[model samples]
Target: MKLTLTLVTIALSINAVFAQKTNPNYDPELATELKADDYGMKTYVFVILKTGTNESKDEELINSSFAGHMANIKRLVEENKLIVAGPMLKNEKNYRGIFILNVSTIKEAELLLQSDPAILEKFLEPELFLWYGSAALSEYLEASDKIWKTKY
Candidate 1:
């Protein structure tokens, strides 16, 4: 009987040790605002901007389209729709850049991409996928704005 009680006690102790505990730093308000799950993560659309078939050598068109693209990026960021956007270095895949959009569906992301002049002009093509990442990812933009000396 003593051995049985000791074994049960050991089993209960092990279960307690392995049980999930609530995060000490968890912020319910922030999590709710961000639409985060219990793990503090939410869904986003990840876009890979690739070089498109529009290889026109027209410098004027290229310049104008790219300028509009940059402007579109700023506008989306201001609207809190685009959480991340940046160019990638030269690669074999012809990937030009990436954008992590703060949107839930691929259709929504496609609609937002339609606003980009680069995509409209066929200078860049987007391949989108649903991404699961930390809800606080957008918060980085606050500090990012302070650190950039030159406006892109």
Candidate 2:
């Protein structure tokens, strides 16, 4: 299954390159908000899931933990604490499991990440990313509301 997913990612990347060649410059339809400095200082993390062995890989625990992760994100959104959150597709390879979230600071972001069942309980090793972008940050946050509302 994992191998199949990897092949799928490779195929997707090749297609994306060709898609770009024809279009050359497709942009995100969402509008961007450009408080670049402020947003840049803020931290956005991306988690890449490592392997899950044995008991932790049990379907129930994996599903339950994912729920907890989403529940935590929902709570943060309700409080207006999260700027954006979502799973990322594999770029060119299929090590594709993780989420991106925007928080006020790296410390706080790490704390929130550690709260996730996968990380907190040693269920998986996750990677982190502090993304840098101009207005893209705002666009993602805006799109995120729609995603949360199930409009996406």
Candidate 3:
């Protein structure tokens, strides 16, 4: 009888432990902001930045285009339309930069790219694709601020 009672107590304790991990009291606002799907993910637009024709080759034009490129990225980030943007370390295949837009449609992403001066000047080109990623990416932005001191 004592063994049966001890076993029952241990089983209840184990069940309680698992319950806390599985059933969390989540915030509704955050769930919506993340756009959590059934699997806690959503769609995004992924863009691959590549070297353009480089027809001009003029140093001034290149510099100006790059300046505009950075500014465009900043603008997208500020607007919350772009979630991730960065450059690759290697110049392989003329790969330059990348962007993950917080958009669901390719048409929307294309329009956003059109506003970039680099694209306008043909100094940088983009290859757009669709991506499915964690919706929490948006929420992590706030958490990231705690780890990084600089903005941008």
Candidate 4:
């Protein structure tokens, strides 16, 4: 399943590259809003959430920790600090999930992550790095609200 998902991601990436080659149907205003570079890319803080060594055996603690963890995610999204976040399908390399922060600096991203219960409780550890991705990522919060009827 992981292999399949990886292949699908690769295929989609290739498709996007080719699709942009012909006519992008580009929007000049959106480009300005997103601060898109020549390649339509923008900087972000990429965070990898990994399983920490300090796991508690108590179910109650785990449940409470995860609840707060999710709440924090919602808060960040509402604040427009986090553009993307989701868990990985596989546990390869102890990686549990990811967070793509709409911030330019690691320090800013770290401060935000510090509020997560998962991080505080040692259920999750974060590794942050600078990343460049499609400027369209900056529009995800608004786009997601339009597409999904569910609210958190």
Q: Which candidate should be chosen as best, given lDDT against the real structure?
A: 1
Candidate 2 local accuracy as lDDT? 0.59
TM-score against native, each model: 0.95, 0.50, 0.76, 0.74
Candidate 2 similarity to native, TM-score: 0.50
Off by over 4 Å in 3: 1-25, 143-152
On a 0 to 1 TM-score scale, where does candidate 1 land against the true structure? Answer: 0.95
Instruction: Evaluate all candidate structures by whole-model CA lDDT and list the values in order.
Output: 0.97, 0.59, 0.85, 0.89
Residues 1-152, candidate 3: write the lDDT tens digits: 99999999999999888863532666667768778775568999999988887689789888888899899888998899989888887875888889999999999999999989888899888999999998877666667658977765
RMSD of 3: 5.3
Model 1 clashes, total count: 0
lDDT of 1 by residue, 24-61 (tens): 99999999998999988999999999999998999999
Ranking by TM-score: 1, 3, 4, 2
Cα misplacement distance, residue 112 of candidate 4 (Å)? 0.7
Compared to the true structure, candidate 3 yields what TM-score?
0.76
The residue-by-residue lDDT of candidate 2 on 104-143, one tens digit each, is 4556667777666755656655666666544455455666
Tell me the deviation in Å of residue 151 in model 2: 7.9
Alpha-carbon runs more than 4 Å astray in model 2 = 1-35, 38-43, 52-57, 88-94, 143-152
Candidate 2 lDDT trough over 10 residues, lowest sum? 30-39
